[model samples]
Target: MTTTPDITLRSRLTTDCELHLPGDPGYDTARLAWNLAVAQRPAAVALPRTPEEVADVVRAAADAGLRVAPQTTGHGAAALGEQDLDDVVLVKLAALTGATVDPTARTARVLGGTQWQEVVEAAAPYGLTALHGSAPDVGVAGYLLGGGLSFYGRSHGVAVNSVRAAEVVTADGALVRASATENADLFWAVRGGGGNLGVVVALEIDLLPYAEVYAGMLLWDRERAPEVLPAWVEWSRTAPESATTSLRVMSFPPLPELPPFLSGRDLIIIDGAILETDADADAVLAPLRALGPEMDTFARVPAAALTQVHMDPPVPSPAVADHSVLGPLDDEAVATLLAQVGPGTRSGLMFAELRHLGGAFARPAAGGGVLASIAGDYALLCLAMAPTPEAVVAGKAAAFSVVRAMAPWAQASLVPTFAETRVDASRFYGDEEWERLLRIRAEVDPHRVFVANHAL
Candidate 1:
C-alpha cells in the first residue's frame, strides 16, 4: 500500500525538529544530496540537530508506517537513489555536526553528520588524526560504516577498525550505545553494515598518533602512463606495509579555475602516504621517483594535510563511477587499461585509478567487524563527471567500459566504500559474515524500518 505521511506524523516530527513535507517551501532544498545527479524524492525530509531530535524523527516516521533513510552529506546517494523512496523519510543530518578530541585517550567523538575535515581539524592540535577518506567533505558515519579505505590503510588497516563505539538510534527510536563491551553484536554489524540496522548519531573512534607525516603527490603527462603504469605495478608488489599509494590516468577539461598544469591536460599521477622516517621514506620512494615526475611534492607535513593529498574536488561534484577489486596487474592487464584511457584514447572519463592494496589491508583486524579486511591486492576505480542527465548516462557507460575491460584482472569481491552502485552485498563479506549480518538486521530492524544505501 502506498503510504503518504499523515498530518499527525508531520506535527510529531516538527515539534522537536525541522520537518519538510512534500510541496513544502523547504522540501526541495532539504532533500538535496551531495551528488546532485541523484534525484531522491522521499516522503518527507527531517533536519535533526541533536541526538534526541534524531530519535524523535525516527520514532515519528516509524509510527506513521514510513521507512527512514539516514543520510549524511550523501556521497553514496547514488545507491539510495536506485531504490523507491516514496515511503521513506530522508533524515538529513547536515546540521548535526560537532567533534571532540580526547587527546589523552587518542580518540575523537564526532556527531553523526560531521565531515572528515571537522574531525581532522579538531584532532590536529593534539598531533593526532583519524582514518579519513581522500575527500574532506565525506561524512564520518557513512565512511566508517562502509569500511573506509584511506591513504593510511596499508599500515593502519581499514578505517572501520578504528571505530571504538557508535551511538545509534535503532528502529524502535531508542538511542543506544554500541561498543566492544556494550551491545557487542550491534557494534560489529554497525562497523561495516552501513546503516542497515540503525541511524548512527555519534561515533567514538581511535585516532592515529602521527601529528606529521611524509605524504604528497607526483604528476606526469599522460604520455608517460605506459612507462609509469607498469613500473608502479612492479614496485607495488615489493613496497612495504608502511607505504600506501594510488596511480591515476586523469583527463581534465579546460577551465580557467584550474591550474595551468591541470587544465585541458591528460596526466598520470601517483600520490599517497609513507609512514616512515624521512630517510626510509625516500629509500622506499626512490624507484618511483626515478620515473622523473614533472611535479614532486613529497615531504614531511602535518598529518591533517593528508586529506588534501588526493586533490579530491574541494566542493561537491556531479560524478559517476565504477569499481572492481583486483588481484594483480599483469602485462596484459596494463595493456588493456592503456587501450581504454591511455595516451591517444578519447575516453571521456575524468580518471581511471589503481590503488595499491595489501599489507595491513589484506589481513583481518585482530578483533574487527564483518568487513575486517579486503582480500584483493589492488582496487580499480573509474570515474567521470556527470553534470547533466545525458552526462550521467554517458559517464556511467564510460566508467563501466574500463571496469569491464579490466574484468580479467578483477576479483569477485568488492570494497564497499569504492562501490558506487548497489551490487551483490554478499560479495562484500564472507559467507558466514553475510549470514551474521542478515541475522542481526532481522533482530534490530525486523520490519525493515531503516533503509540503507547498500542494504544487507
Candidate 2:
C-alpha cells in the first residue's frame, strides 16, 4: 500500500482535491495527453475540483520551487512533449468542465478544461458558435491558449482574437482576471502565446450567430490536379474574406465506410467555406466550380458538418504534418508544390493542404489579439498520415524541405502551434513579439512559474 506525503502543500487547499501518486489507478490516465509521441510521467497529478484548488497547486509548486507543466487538453500536446520535464506537477484540469452562453451578447464562459464538442453543443441553442477546430474532440483550453485555428478563421480571424476575458492562476498563486482593462498585456500574450505565462482557469469569449453554414468538401479525381490546382490558385487571389478556402492533394486508403469515389483513390480535392449572410455562395465560388470536379458535394450543411472541409481522417492513424506559410504562389512555386506532393508524384504523403490567407485573417481586430504580424497570402500545410514511422519521417522531410526550398517567398516565421520539434521561440513569433511576451511573463509571473518549450 502507498501512503500520502507529509507535505504542507496538499494540506493547504480548501477544495476536495485528489492527488495521483506514481502507481495509482488514475495516475497514468492523468499524466497521459493526446499526442502518441509524448511519453510523460509527472511527480504527482493534481486534479483540482475548484479554482481555489487550482490556485493551491500553483502556490504549492511555487513554494516547492518546482515549475509547472500544465495540460488542459491534448490537442497541442506535440509541442509539450518535447521538454526535459521532471519535478513538475501535472495540473490535470478535466474536472473544471463548466460552460454557459449569453446568446444576446454572443459570448460564452468556458471552464479551463472544456473540450470543443461541449462548446458546440452548449452554443447550439443560441444558434451560435465560437470559432473552433475541425476535430470535435479537440480541447478548448489548450486550443485557445495555443492560438486557436478554425474553419472560420479566414473570415472571422483566429480563435484567440475573439477572447474577451480569461480567468487565470498566475505563477504567484494569485487568481487574476485578465481582460482589456485588467492586465491588458497579459491578455494579449495569452491570446497567441504558448502556455508559458500561467494556467488559465476559465475563458470568456465572443461567439458567432452561426448554426448553419455553406460548408463541406469537393473531391476530384487525381489525374486532373495539374489541370485543376493551378486555376484554383488564381481564383484564390480574388476570393473575399467571407470565404475561407483550401486545396488538398489526397490519396485516401481503400476501406469500408469511406466515400466510394474517395476510397482507394488518389484525388485533387478542393475544400471551401463560404460564410453566408444570405448570399449565393455558389455564385462567388463559380470560377473554381467552372474548373469542374469529378465529384462535388458543396452546399449548405450543419456547423458540426464543417469537419468535412478537411475530411481529416476520422480514425487515428500514425501521422506527421509539415508546414510553411507562403507569401505568394507564382506559377513556379505552385507547380513545384504540385509536382512534389500532388497526384503524379505518389510520394508516400496523404494530403497537402494549401489554405488561402490574407483578407480578414491578416487584418487586426478592433482590439488587438493573438499574433498580428502575419500578412502572408497562403499557408502550405502537408498532412502526412502514413501507416508507419519511416513513411512519416520521409514524407515530412520531402514536404518541408520543399518549403525551405521556397524560403525566399515563404514567411520566415511559423505559427507556434503548427511548428514541429525545432523549439526556437524567435521563429514562431518575431523577436519583438517574443520579447514582449517574456516581459509580460516577468510582470505577471516573475518567478518563472510555468513551463513552456516549443519547436520552431
Q: Largest lDDT belongs to which candidate? A: 1
For each candidate, give its TM-score against the true structure: 0.98, 0.89
- Candidate 2 on 273-320: residue-level lDDT in tens? 789753578887778778777767778877766754676545434555
Q: What is the C-alpha lDDT profile of model 1 across 326-346, one tens digit per residue?
A: 998899999999999999998
lDDT (Cα, 0-100) at 256 in candidate 1: 100
Report the C-alpha displacement of residue 301, candidate 2, in angstroms: 2.1
lDDT of model number 1: 0.92
- In angstroms, the error of model 2 at 92 is 3.1
After superposing candidate 2 on the true structure, give the runs of residues whose Cα lies further than 4 Å from its correct spot.
1-16, 277-279, 313-317, 386-392, 395-399, 453-456
Clashing pairs in 2: 422-455, 422-456, 423-454, 423-455
What RMSD does each model have against the real structure?
A: 1.1, 3.7
Model 1 Cα shift for residue 219 (angstroms): 0.4
Model 2 residue 81 CA deviation (Å) reads: 1.1
True lDDT of residue 257, candidate 2: 83
